[model samples]
Target: MSLKGKRVIVVGGTSGIGLSTAKAFLEEGAQVVIASRSSAKLSEAKQTLGGNVETYELDFRSEENAASLFKKVGEFDHLVITAGEGAMGDFRELPVDQAQTAFNSKFWGQYMTVKAALPYLNKEGSISLTSGVYGKRPAKGASTLAAINSALEGLMRGLAVDLAPIRVNVVSPGIVDTPVYAGMPEEHRKSMFNAIASQLPVGRVAQPEDIAEAYVYLAKNGFTTGTVILIEGGALLS
Candidate 1:
């Protein structure tokens, strides 16, 4: 289960949970490659990761771009996709176009990434995807988010069966303090985090590092497949 010298690729790894997951792999002595669509973010990640990893500018939404990415990478041991943005709003009022975009990025994007990466993946390797707690314990005004995450988990299960021996799994994390919420007003954001934290038994909101560990575990554990590891601080219980 030791990751030393293993080749791991993390798509959408420039910031937030993706960046933290890359750092965790590095700490375990793995050869890490981080990919993002933004070249500027990639540069920042390189510096943050202490310059020992490879960086690729990848737009996972496009099949061609994803294929090009793996072509450059050649072959890799594990593929982790923590990219994609989810939309949050009332189902009735939310714009249909925006919801479609969310699904395209978060659900279809990961799907394409997996398809592109499979050819270049080692037979013994694994694929870890990202999901969210809303997929299971949805809240009001987050119907679209729930659908996207739920679809991802379903996809993972099917993939595990179809691509046997090459483990496929997902990490379903609850609220985490990542840049994904940067668009909200500062005060409102803090207030929201505090409100959720109070309900959780953990008594604190999760950080990127907290969720990052789940990805690491999924990659290292060969026996675990078609699983959704919930690192949600007992959110469903609360």
Candidate 2:
């Protein structure tokens, strides 16, 4: 789908899936804006993208910041939010503050971004949010993540109806090899990823580019809304 002349905003676009999505949109001739909390990362991303791309330093956890950032961003054809924190641990053992922090950063972060951007979005414009496979299927050591993911999906679906002419959807990706997992214990991480890859019918984990196609698809398809597209490499089927 051609996005020539379209203006798109990608929150959390400094790295991983969001960064990949921004590049894809730019390659399609769309004017892209990338927002994140890190100025250093944003600068790096700008240098990497190298064009007329706009960069904004945004802290989604702060409602004021979110509103201000969107206001400064003005209007756009698409708003994609991939900003979130991944908190893994047993719910009972996890600190309440930690869970709340995760929720504030991811769930409410996306909510505030959408709420702020809705008025600025053109008619038939789309809002894409990110969830995860754990939202649909439970996993060990992911209680907080699961809850937040499920909440994000529900938020998008409800907003789809409320937003009406504007579309809302979520992308749920599983086991993508990204820098986010770099902190995991080497041996354990390797085993975990291998196990995940082996279980999938596709015989491999996903990449940022793999899931990026889904985001581009949803953005271009006007009739599709209130849906969560899973890019789990068939892991959901297994």
Candidate 3:
């Protein structure tokens, strides 16, 4: 689908899935803006994206920053939220603050972004949030992530109906080979992903580009709203 002239904002676009999505939009002739808490990363992203791209510094955990970022963004045809925080620990062992951080980043951060952008969104504009396969299929040591992602999906569906003409949707991806996993212990990370990938019908983890198409589809399809597009390589098949 052609997105020529579309004004798009991609939060957390400095790296991972968000960065790839931003590039995809730019390639489609859309003017894109990328926001992140990291100025260094944002500057690098701006240089890489080159034309018709803008970068903003935002730490979504801060209410003031979230509000200010959207205010400065003014208006846009689509807003894509791919920023999230992750924690791995048993529910009982996990610190409350750790869980809160994840919730605040993914759930509340998304809420704040959407709330602030509502006034500036075009009549036919769309909002897309990132959830994940964990939201649907829970796993050990991932309770916090699962809960937050599930909540995000529910929020998007409810908002889609409440927002009406302004479409809202969730993109739930499976294991994606992004920088987000760079911090994990190498052996454990490899084993974990290998097991996860083996279970998927496709026998492979997703790439950022694989999931980016779903976001682009949801944005262009006016008739689709309150929907969750699964980019999981059939991981949920079982």
User: TM-score winner among the candidates?
Assistant: 1
Candidate 3 wrong stretches, greater than 4 Å: none
User: Model 3: per-residue lDDT, tens digit, 105-194?
Assistant: 889988988888888889798999999988888778889989998999999989998998899999998889998989889998899788
Query: Relative to the unseen true structure, what is the C-alpha lDDT of residue 25 in candidate 3, on a scale of 0 to 100?
Result: 88
TM per candidate comes to 0.99, 0.96, 0.95
Q: Write the per-residue lDDT of candidate 2 for residues 61-168, one digit (tens) a residue.
A: 888898898789887899999888868888788898998989998899999888888778987689999999998886888888999999999988899999988899
Pairs in steric clash, model 1: none
| Candidate 3 lDDT (Cα, 0 to 1) | 0.89
Q: Give the TM-score of candidate 1.
A: 0.99
Q: Which digits, one per residue and each the tens of the lDDT, describe model 1 over residues 6-37?
A: 99999989999999999999999999999999
C-alpha lDDT values of all predictions: 0.94, 0.89, 0.89
As a TM-score, model 3 comes out at 0.95
